[model samples]
Target: MIRWAASLGLILAITLAAPGAHGQSPAGAYETLRLIDGVRVLMNPADHASFASSNVVIIEQADGLVVVDSGFSRADGDQIVSYIRSFTAKPVKALIYTHWHNDHHQGASQIQAAWPQVRIIATEAARRGIDGPARLEGVGYETNPAWEALLAGQLRDVAARYQEAAANPENDAWRRHRFGQAAQQSLDGIPALVGTRLTAPTELFTADLVIDDPLRPVHIRHLGRANTDGDLIVWLPNQRVVATGDIVVSPIPFGFGSYPGDWIETLGRIKALGFHVLIPGHGLPQSDSAYIDRLIAAIADIRTRVGALAAEGLTLEQVRERVDYAEQTAIFGPSPARQANFQSLWLSPMTENAYKEATGVPIVQGQGELP
Candidate 1:
C-alpha cells in the first residue's frame, strides 16, 4: 500500500553551484537542490538542450544511499558520484531507474563501477525495453558519419541563431542564448559515450516494490504507461516527494512511444498521491502540481482535438494542420522558435500517437533503419 505524508511544506530552495566548486568541469556543473531532509535533487545544467540529461534524485538512507535515476552518459554518472561524495561518505546501495530512457539509465554502468555491490532496480517492462531496439528509428546517429555531419551542421546553424539572439538584449533572446550554450555543452559530452557501458537492471518488479528500509521506505510504483510502457515513479512518502521519471517532463512533455490516453490517467494517479514536491525526469524540481496539471491538460487536449479531427475523416497531415496548439504554445513559450521546437518534440509525435490510438491504427515498432 502507498502511504501519504501530512502537510510537508513544499518550499523551492534550490542552490545552484558550479561543478568547479567540486573540482568538476564547468560544462558538467549541475544544480543541487535539497528538497527535504535526506533528499536532494541533482539537475543537469543543460536541461533545455536536446538529449541534455535527466534529473537525478539522491536519498540518504540509514545504511548507505538510494539513487533514483542515473544520468545521460558515463561522465554524467561520474559527476553524480562526485557530487554525492562531496557531502556524504555513504556508499550507493541501490540505483533505482525511473524508466528505460537512455538518458535516465545509461549512467548506471558508472554507478556500478564506483560501487559494484549496488543493486540496480527497474520495472520488468523497463528491463526488457532497455535491451530492445532504439525507441525512435534513426536516433542513434553517433555511429554514422553522415548523420554526425548533419547534426554538426544543425548545431552550427543554431550557433548562428544564438549569436543573433545574443545581440537582441531581450529576455527571450537571453534564454535562447543560454539554451544554445547548454546544447553545445551537451554536445561536448557526446564523446564520453564512445566507450561508455550501459548497465541493465539487476532487480525487476512487476507492480510495486518497497526498498524495505526502516528509516526511509522508498515505494516504487508503475502507474500505467505514460512516457513509455515501463514508466515508473519513485514515491518518497515520508518526504512527500515523487520522482516522476519521464511521465511529467517540464517545459514540454516527450511523447515518443507514449500512450496519450493512459498517460492522462497516470497523471491523475500521480496527483492523487498529493506529493508536495515532484522530481521530474528532466528539468528542475517542481514544488507544486501546476506543471503536472499543465502536462495532463496538454495530453487530454491532444486526445480530444486529434480524436475529433480523425473522426471527421481527416488524415494525419490534415489533422496536424487543423489542430493548432496555440494554448500550449502560449503557456510553454510564445516565440516562433520555441513553438517550432515544442511542435517537433511533443506536438507532432503526440498528434500522430493520439491519432493512432483514436483510429485503431497499430503502432509499428522498429520499422525504419537504425541510424
Candidate 2:
C-alpha cells in the first residue's frame, strides 16, 4: 500500500491514534497493525485505514539493544516503545535514524523518556538535518530561482495535500483526527522548546560499521545517497536481514525526493549486500532477494528511459508520456494520491539530480546535493 505523505519538516508534536468507541472508528482514528519477525523485524502500521507507516527496529546487540527509526507522532512513539518492551526489557541502548524525514525521527523524544540513557545515533548529515534546515532550504534563495520555484511548488503541493486530507472526513478520518491532535500538540510543543531537550544522537559517524555483538551482529552500511543525503541501510548478516530506508518500498520507490542514478546505485549496492531478507521502510517485510533484484532492474529501466529523454532534449512531461513503468506503478496501489508519487519521482530534486548525473550537468540551486 502507498503510505500517505506527511510534512517532512522537523516540527514538534505528539499525536495519538484514536481508538474507536464501541468498535466504531472515532472521528480520526486508525487501528494499529504490528508486523514482527520474532525479534528481527517490527513494523507499526500508522493510520491502519490509510497507508501511514513508520518503523521500530530492535537490534539485539552484544552489549545492549539498538533501536532504529521511530514512526510519526507521539502515538507511534508510544506504540513502538510498548512493542519493544514486550520483547525485551533491555533498555534501548542506541537509536539510529535512517534519514532525517519527520516520520522517521519525530518519535525519538518519546524513546528518550522510556530509555533515558539510550545513546541516539545518526549520521552527521542526518544529525545536522534534525538540528538544521534541509541543505536545499539553506541555499534556496542564494541558488537559481528556477530551482527554488521547483522546490517551493513541490512543498506547497505537499502542504496543500496534507491540508486537504486533514480536512476531509473520508480520505482518512482516522489520520485526520489523529494528526489533527498531533498538529495541536505541535502547537503546544512550542513552549517546551526553550528548555525542552530532545533526545539526539551523541555519536555521529560516516562509513560502514559492523556492530559485532552476538545478539545483534548487524552491518550498518552507508549506501551513499539514495533517498536523502544521509541514507543508510542496516544489514543483519546473521539473520540475513536488511532494512532499506525509503530506498525500496512496496509498489514504487518514493522518488519524489530521490536521486535516481544514486538511488539506482544504492539498489545495486543493496543487491550486492547478499542478504536473504529485505525489509523496506514501508509495507510488509519482503524476504525475497529476487524482489530486491527486481527493484534494481526497475530503477535501471527508469534511468534508461529518463536518460534517453534528456538525451533527446525532451521535456519531463514528454518523457513521462513516453516512459511507462506500469509494473512499478502498480506496486503503489490505486488512488489519486498516487499522482503525487509520479510528480515526486519526476519533478523532485532527486529526479533532477539523476538527470544531471546522467547528463554530467552541475546540479542547480534549490536542488539537493548528493553527499
- Model number with the top TM-score: 1
TM-score of 1: 0.79
lDDT of 2 by residue, 142-220 (tens): 2244433433343344344445557877756655765454444333333222211224566777977666675457677
Alpha-carbon runs more than 4 Å astray in model 2: 1-40, 46-53, 134-199, 315-353, 361-371
lDDT of each: 0.68, 0.56
Q: How do the predictions measure up, each by TM-score?
A: 0.79, 0.68
**Candidate 1 residue 179 C-alpha distance from true site, Å:** 6.7
Tens digits of lDDT, candidate 1, 58-138? 998888999988776667788888888899889999999887666677677778888999999999888766665332324
Check candidate 2 and list the clashing pairs.
28-173, 28-174, 29-174, 60-215, 60-216, 120-201, 251-331, 251-332, 256-344, 258-350
Per-prediction CA RMSD (Å):
8.4, 8.2
Full-model lDDT, candidate 1? 0.68
